[model samples]
Target: MERLHHHKVLTTVTWLLSIIISIYYTFEKPHDGVWPRRKIWHQNDKFHTAFRLNSIIASIYWIVLFVLQGGYIAHLFSGTVEHVNAACSVGSHFIVNNLFHFAFVMLFVRSYFGWAELFIILNFFNLSSLYFRHPGYARFIHTPVVSGPLAWTFIAIYWNGAIMVPHPDTLVARIFGNIFIWSILVYGLFFIVVYKDYTMGFNLSVLSAAIGVSQFLRQVVAFQWIFAFVIMAVLFVATLVVAVPAATGRDIKFARARAGDTERAPLLGEN
Candidate 1:
């Protein structure tokens, strides 16, 4: 309960925990997969340095955003904001649920990251319950803006952070993780697009506002259960179809190299 009052604390903690989790995923190979035998972190020195510098910039960006959007967070917890009857408009309920889910998303990123259904569900009810406060611009501040790319971007750096999925060995985990990973990935793209925009204006706040219209399209207009399911299925199958052959191809190349089966030398006349 005390945690609700300190959103900044929540932000910092989430980022810090994510950083630790990333370290594990980056260096330690899991038993379930082929472990990398080389020291890869040092392989790309230039990119590594760039990543560190940009990570700092990303940190500064979040601190500034937390300050600017601090008030909207109050609406989420104040509990006194008028609550609307979701039954009146099921669409409104959908809008508010998505908004709240996305709005506090950074704070709740771990929930989605771990595929925590109860956590996500509770958050949806809590955020939507408060957001529809009878209804207006106040609601927009919740999901489309907060859960939108601009605000939800705090975790973009770790979009591939879901390392603890249902485990690849199980069919259900494979399908579930694949679909869940693919769904959240739509938001991951926001980071790349918005970061590109950052190159133009060099301003984080500007990027946030710039993302508004796009968020409206994604959150309010186009995204639906059926649409998401179709995309999820495609991504799932594509991952399997592409990954299986790719892995096999790599294995074949390694075997051929070991066997000294080099590409046939061109004949004297074929040069």
Candidate 2:
């Protein structure tokens, strides 16, 4: 009776929360300040003659994310469907599935903007995934075992211009893009490995690296040498910063696991 009551309470809370979030995203003014109703972009363009493309892209991206995330939440709580493993499947149904959809959408939208930095921002999803994992939000996001590596690959491609713009000669923009992409990749590798899925991480990392190298080679041969070199340097530094801490943490976790196994083995042998 107690277990059944607990389950019912959990289900009720989940439904209520989902409904609330859905309503908020559907109607509320976005905190990120990119509302379609506002003419901020037009106003800026008229006065400054400088295009704030990143800001515009960021705004649109936020709207898409809000809608998709909201829809996924609604689907989970609709209660019109029944199946075994419904509880376990809820996370995958919305969060993970919608993520790929979201990525594909971003890919198309990014092509219009032609800004590598904007696409690089997509890497933050990995860090967001990791942070959410602590609260079991990973289950809610339906974040897959493959999300982290996939994110890294996306970042790599974005940086190398496979997924975003190759032009615009601004050092500051490139630097910001590099930092954002690298942070996500490093953070992603940590979470993916911690989840005990090294194979996926390794495979994705290698593939992304290969793509990055190939892109770099193409750029260099085409005489876009300065941008390619600078971007590569930024990528190398960012990778080191993000990967080092994650790798160290993984080593400690593995050591602890081995010790526990050794201790348990002796007890079992005595039995």
Q: Evaluated with lDDT, which candidate comes out highest?
A: 2
Top TM-score: which candidate number? 2
**Span of ten consecutive residues with least summed lDDT in model 1:** 262-271
Model 2 shows how many backbone clashes? Answer: 2
Model 1 residue 179 CA deviation in Å: 4.7
User: Can you list the residue pairs that collide in candidate 1?
Assistant: 99-143, 102-147, 103-146, 103-147
Please provide, for model 1 over 1-271, each residue's C-alpha lDDT reduced to its tens digit, 9 standing for 90 to 100: 4543344345434434533443443354333423322211221111211011123333445445444444433434444422111111222333343343343333222233343334354544544353334222222232332333232342232222322233322445434433543333353233223321111122322232322222233345432233334433443443344335435654211121112211211111110
Error of 1 at 35 (Å): 22
**Cα lDDT listed for each candidate:** 0.32, 0.36
Off by over 4 Å in 1: 1-61, 71-117, 132-135, 138-164, 168-271
Q: Itemize residue pairs with steric clashes in candidate 2.
A: 91-142, 95-141
Error of 2 at 139 (Å): 13
Evaluate model 2: give its TM-score: 0.33
Per-residue C-alpha lDDT of model 2 across residues 138-227, encoded as one tens digit per residue: 222322322432443354444334223343335544455444445434543564444433323433343334434433443434222333
